[model samples]
Target chain A: MTVDTAPDTQSQIHWFLIGMRGLFSLPAIILMLSFVGFAAFTAEANIPVDQVMFMTGMVWALPAKVILVGSMLSGAHVATAFIAVTLSSVRMMPMVAALIPEIRDRRTPTWLLLIISHFVAITAWVFAMEKVRDVPRYGRVAFFAGFGITLTVTNIILVGLVYGAVSSFPPIVSGCLFFLTPVYFLTSIWISARHRVIYWALGIGLALGYLFAVIAPEYDILLAGIIGGTLAWWGEKRLRQKEAGQ
Target chain B: MSFDGVWPYIYIAIAGWLATDIWRWAGVIAGKRIDENYETLNWVRAVATALVAAVIAKLIFFPTGALENSPLWLRLGSILFGALCFFIGGRFRQPLGIAAAIAFLAAGLALIGL
Candidate 1:
């Protein structure tokens, strides 16, 4: 008798639905608040709402979107904005590297893998990473796809709603909402971390980043990342060496 | 140049896609070939971590627009309070921290007469 082994349609659908539940998960809610705030920022700053939509869908990275919108609002050329946004999002490559390992398998199609790569971000990536461990290995990619894609759609809708209603909200409220984006990312950084090394790195990075901001605001982000990350990397290495030596 | 015509969208689509998606595709191709535990990947993660750290610090210290107008102590106070909320409880910590930060800033806005 031949063994009939295939991904049954119902089972796949079942797992996909399980993943789709991420749309309303805690992280998703936080992301929605940030997106709504982003819409308000764009509305108030005279940034075209359509660009927000474009960044929401095409560039799923939040920090990049923030940089893009902020730079453009400051009258930076499109090329300069692109460079800053791109450099900021370079982190996503490592993010994807960390996440792809959790879901990739022989059964996951190449096309699916390509498409799902677009969905990786700090919010969805961390949430999916935590949840993927619970899913059957074969279905994990599908699960991430379901969770991530739905979250994006939800964010896009929230952006539209908030942008349309932004004029009604007081300028103070819009200002408060804008602050939420950075705080959301900042809070998540502290919350999601699992080690002291990261804390040390972030501490040094923040200090160095602030110093650089005072000295050379134009290259603050770049200099802080390189100098601080290199130091953190050195710290992590020393820790590892110590552990191995002991 | 300024976003003056249809060329802006075209530029965004092409340059933005290449800028962001290139790394993603690199991850896809590399993930297929390398072990998840590759050491160099750690360097990548560390860099990513520090990048976010820098971005957040920039927002707090070198802010622009509405954020720029706010008093420095107010911003620091907001983050401090938000961190306090995050560590105070387990569930809803992220949202709670976020809410605290927003409320703190909102209060600042009110004090300054919006």
Candidate 2:
């Protein structure tokens, strides 16, 4: 009287295993919390929670939330908000260029790029650049897929929590979540600062950018990144030549 | 319930996703031919990293939302303490530990009414 269902049973078992593997990993959970925490914080800060949730799931930069939220709050047209957010993300061009060579494979399908692109956040990008060096080209996509799946699930859960529990959560908890974005970036910079010139450049760039942002709210990031980066590059070249001459 | 009611938001979401995905696809296509050590690539990495750093500084110092309500010194002080935690945690070569410590310091400061 038993039903013939071996394939269905096996598929269920396989999915169960996959779910267990993803759920049990500590790093996966931590990475998930970092993503959710920041996204939820951004939502509480008056950004369009759903749009940001969707964007965090889709794109790599949470800072793009700045543009999305800012443009909307300022009563910009939806078209303008989209344009501003898209423009902010133009920086990803260099990020992808730098990271792809480390992870590309001849056998990798072109479509997988679209999938992996979803996992391309500040956290994933920084981690991949730092740790994906030794991973074989074929495995890089798998690694990121696994990591991306973890992030995607995390974002969905956190969005639900924030949306459902928006009133109950303390403002400071949200503030703490916002704090993680900056903390993560600064720590990464500290760990990766290899050259003296880089250190000085980052210091000057941050200082000047902060000052400029205080004075001129709208164009601060663009002004600082372009101007500060240019000045630092020039300063480093000059310093290198001076050392070489001596 | 009506499709028209939610269509614009949905459209924006999908469009945002697609726009960013375009660059990733380009990366995959171009990555095979590009040299990693190219000077231009290195320069791009430097600029990207610096830009991210600038964004971090801006968020902390000139924050919006609940953070804007907190005192300026408290925000800066918590970040400094977090940076210190990062250095000390790095002494153990634990990046995760440093990140957790930074998160903990911020939460702790907030809980203490700072």
Candidate 3:
């Protein structure tokens, strides 16, 4: 027997409400905490207080923001700064690709289709990927918008407030705050993986990253990413073909 | 174009911002049209996954700022313990390791005085 998947009308509304309720979700909370760490980074770097809000609103990705600030602070040329930041954020593309289709229905407007694309941050992507299947397609986008917009706006305000206050906190406290983002990211990655390919990819990628960091710190991450990814993809293809042949 | 001026930050933010946004918009367009299993899509996920892994490894292995003060052994020890605890916590409760790891590191910090 076939299982019915399309949610009923009332259930769609419920899903929409559930999405809106995502404001209180753990991912949203982690998103805010990550911004707190970023605020502390700016404060420590002695970035002008006025620019903090600007960065938060414009370069919303924390990794891109980190690269942008680091490049400029290091006296890198303008082109160099732009490239570094852009490269750091390239991961968002696949993330958006993976998440957008999961929720959008025929009624979703083109303008909205584009606008919410910005909400495909790592936290939002990870969270939405896990949640979209639970909701009807018609309501899933609204749910994403509800939680995504809430987190983004909350983070903007949090960045502003934390920027003004982070300097006052002791170094260790701020350090721990900074540490939270990457730790959260790592944990989330491990939790999200359900396939053998991803598991192999993660292990190989991490090992390569560590080895390269020790030997060539300047250009290791990008190179390691490329090589490790290619290797993982190759292995996955080989394994998949073998299984299919059976 | 003074390095210290506010304009550089704005310029980089806008340029880099657009550069970054381009991919997501492209994703939206492509995701709408292509099957999720399109062959090349695997490369994108793989690369992104690797980048994420690299980012995490960097943070844990060669962290900056206050984290720099903690000895390498201490940082590694905490993560090792955290991962072990995470595995033990099982699927639904993995986040418990995050708190446990933090507490483990905090306890070490108290003893070592970072």
Cα lDDT tens digits for candidate 2, B1-114: 122356536645644666556656665555545655554554555565666667767877887666776777777777666666655664653455445645665666656685
lDDT of each: 0.74, 0.61, 0.73
Which predicted model would earn the best TM-score? 3
Clash pairs for candidate 2: A60-A120, A60-A121
**lDDT string, candidate 1, B4-114, tens digits:** 667656656654656688878887776666545656656655666676677778878767556667788988999999989888958878878888888988887788786
Ranking by TM-score: 3, 1, 2
Alpha-carbon error at A162 in model 1, in Å? 3.2
Q: How many residue pairs in model 3 have overlapping backbones?
A: 0
Find the number of clashing residue pairs for candidate 2: 2
- Candidates' chain B TM-scores in the order shown: 0.78, 0.62, 0.75
Which pairs of residues have clashing backbones in candidate 3?
none
Candidate 2 lDDT score relative to the true structure = 0.61
Task: Write model 3 residue lDDT over A1-246, tens digit each, in one string.
Answer: 122455466765666677768878766776787788788888878877667666666667777778777876787777777677767776676667656667787666767878888877777876887777766677787788877777777787888777877767765665566666666776777777755666666777788889889997766677677788889989998989999999
Q: Which stretches of candidate 3 lie over 4 Å from their true place?
A: A1-17, A106-111, A214-219, B1-9, B36-39
Which regions in candidate 2 have their CA more than 4 angstroms from the true location?
A1-31, A34-53, A69-75, A105-111, A192-201, A238-246, B1-4, B22-37, B90-114
